[model samples]
Target chain A: MTADLHTLTGAYALDALSPEEAREFARHLTECDVCTHEVAELRETAARLALAVAEVPPAALRARVMAAIPEVRQLPPPGRVADVVPLRGRAWRQRLPYLALAACLVGAAVAGGVAVNAEHDVDRQRTQAEQQASDLASLMAAPDAAYHTTAVHGGGNATVVSSVSQARTAFVYRDLPKLAGSHVYELWYSRKGSMVPAGLVDSGRPSGTAVLAGAASGADGVGLTVEPHGGSKQPTTSPLMLVSIAG
Target chain B: MRAAAREEQPGAPRPGALETLLDRVSRGDRDAFESVYTAVAGSVLGLVRRVLRDPAQSEEVTQEVLIEVWRSAARFDPGQGSAMAWIMMLAHRRAVDRVRSAQASADREHKAAVRDHSPAFDEVSEQVERRLEREQVRRCLGQLTELQRESVTLAYYRGFTYRETADLLGAALGTVKTRLRDGLIRLRDCLGVSV
Candidate 1:
């Protein structure tokens, strides 16, 4: 299957994939070093083809484009760890609750899923907490990050902060109905006609913020479902809430 | 000042001018943006025109693409690709998106019929001033197998999906996919571009 996806680099670089396929391949590119390199080279080749067909545009385009530049706002550079430092006191304080909740989720997952070694779980939990904090910081500070909020069917609201350029997404759940038993909330990246498991949240947690697993770039939407512990290979229950990322 | 230095040189832009100009544009330098525009507008417009075929829409898209470069200049990571590749990718994707959106509403058969009659590659736009590049690209394209050449051109220049390209050429979908990859590998080698 991956080899088949590997061949998609040429078509992908040429802009020949269907939108859904393009998104899937883009997610693939984020993980596959070989595809990433090939796509870049092929894109360079495509750019050369553009040079072949280059034509002088109507001269008026220059005036219009220049006139339009002033009204447009340029995006800020990607967030650096140092750039995020200034926001640590206020912005970081504001995000403390979410961070704490995310840490709890990591703690719970490690405790419940890896009960074999208590010492190992503690170490893993600490590492994950640190990772999530940094990931959340950079994601929140991303220049292109956008927030999408949708009402959960059983309860309150779910907001997704997605940074496509960063290929990461973070989720904040508010007032979600408490799950019972071993059921957990599973995050999914809704592609064309299928749902891909993105991550799992500890069951019975009513509200929290956690970064969803996997590449979120080009996902059509994000969906949440109640699933058995450890999560399902595919969504076993219909999504309780579906948030379109197109916005 | 750098733009002035560039103005003294005739012909194609100096290597790395676009990248340098983009860095300036990201810092809100209008003069650098102009230099960037002057360097890339023709290629952006020409690519859009080839894909859209409608001159007015092509111009609008070219404007959008350039403005996008200005707005997202900070997003351009030189580590990922060259400035020209970044700009052209933006232009090509915008053109392909518009055409595909339009196709979603229009008659598919009519669209295919129109595409069928269009030349495999239109005469290199007479307005293209880069004669050496035009000839070099033409020569490299000429070296591909007929199937490989058609697959690449139909998808890249004509904005057809691989499945669509396969259907048009009466080839299997898998064959078209391989040909597109193989064809690009050949072009990449011929052009001497390394990732």
Candidate 2:
């Protein structure tokens, strides 16, 4: 007489069955959604039991694990790497709507009298701007990156490339009025009603980029406000630009 | 900055935070890997210790399991299970492999010596029973009949195959199988774990 395969569920869940028996159960599992769900739940329960018994590990273990990490090779991310195409060539130009919007802001900046002075300085700024563009292109190319463009309250506009999965954000701005003395543009990530400082951006440049150390996953949106040079711990002025990051 | 963020929560880690960190770890983020290690190492060590009953051996197995996590993190699919589950599954398998190999005879001898020196079984059972009262899963495990619990604990926490569990518990293979099934069913219900 054949043994009932149903009796093997617990054994299978706990991984106690012999390899031959496990193979038999695997065959049975394909046709049985009930068994599949049951096994999943039982395994989760087993895992919880493991979690419940958690004790403090040796303090030295952390140091050991951290020390070993760099020596170990990480698995390559699954799927084609080419699927994440870098923003280059035609792809770069395709974001021209944003570029055009930024161009308008640049015109506004020139009108706002943000002094584009010496030819040498102009050439240096152009090089910096190109570098910033390339940086923004790479940020946009990241698989998790999302782009958002928002108009500055008065005239210009800003673009934010954020990746919650990467816990990083790139903020690019154009045509915004530069502040004099000890003043800078500060980025803030707003969640609910509270805002946290993300990073600081130079106010002198006609267009500039800044990478912030924060994740967009939980943030309601991003905001930009003028802060004292070296940046303020809190926003002392209203946001000049606000962009909703959440869908 | 991260230390300050962690200080706000103290020891209470957010649910699904490990999953998020593992995603980052898979992408080869060293900071996230360190955070994930700090978060889960305690539980990993605890499970390994419980199975091996040898602190030194458990530590070795725990290291191997964690190193495996680093190597194979890209294969982890959140759609299948929680990060803790995935990590513990690796820990359990490694711990079991350690205790089931030729080296296990030495472990068994060590356990025998410890058993000889230990107090009566009743005292150990009472202590275990008292400890079970504090945890939901342990409390559920307490509800199982003595034999069912023995069969399950032997096959599961002790990493014994059904045949080995039967030999250890001095029961037939069929009896061990049935008790394990019935015991797990009760555990699933008592824990309110949904299928």
- The lDDT per prediction is 0.70, 0.63
In model 1, which runs have C-alpha deviations exceeding 4 angstroms? A81-247, B1-16, B103-128
lDDT string, candidate 2, A97-199, tens digits: 4433432342222212133356876687567656544444444323334455556776666666565555556775656776777677778876654666786
What's the DockQ for every one of the candidates? 0.21, 0.19
Docking class of 2: incorrect
Q: Give the CAPRI class of candidate 1.
A: incorrect
Scored against the true structure, residue A181 in model 1 reaches a CA lDDT of 82
Score candidate 1 by DockQ: 0.21
Best by DockQ: 1
* Model 1 TM-score on chain A: 0.50
How well is each residue in B41-127 modelled by candidate 1, as lDDT tens digits? 778987887778766667788999999999998887766877789999999998888888865325333443342222222111212
Kindly list the per-residue Cα lDDT of model 2 for residues B1-195, writing each as its tens digit. 122212223322221155545655676766556545644666677677778887667777888888889888877655455566678888887887787787774775486334121221111011111122126666888999998889888877778898898998899998999988888889878976653
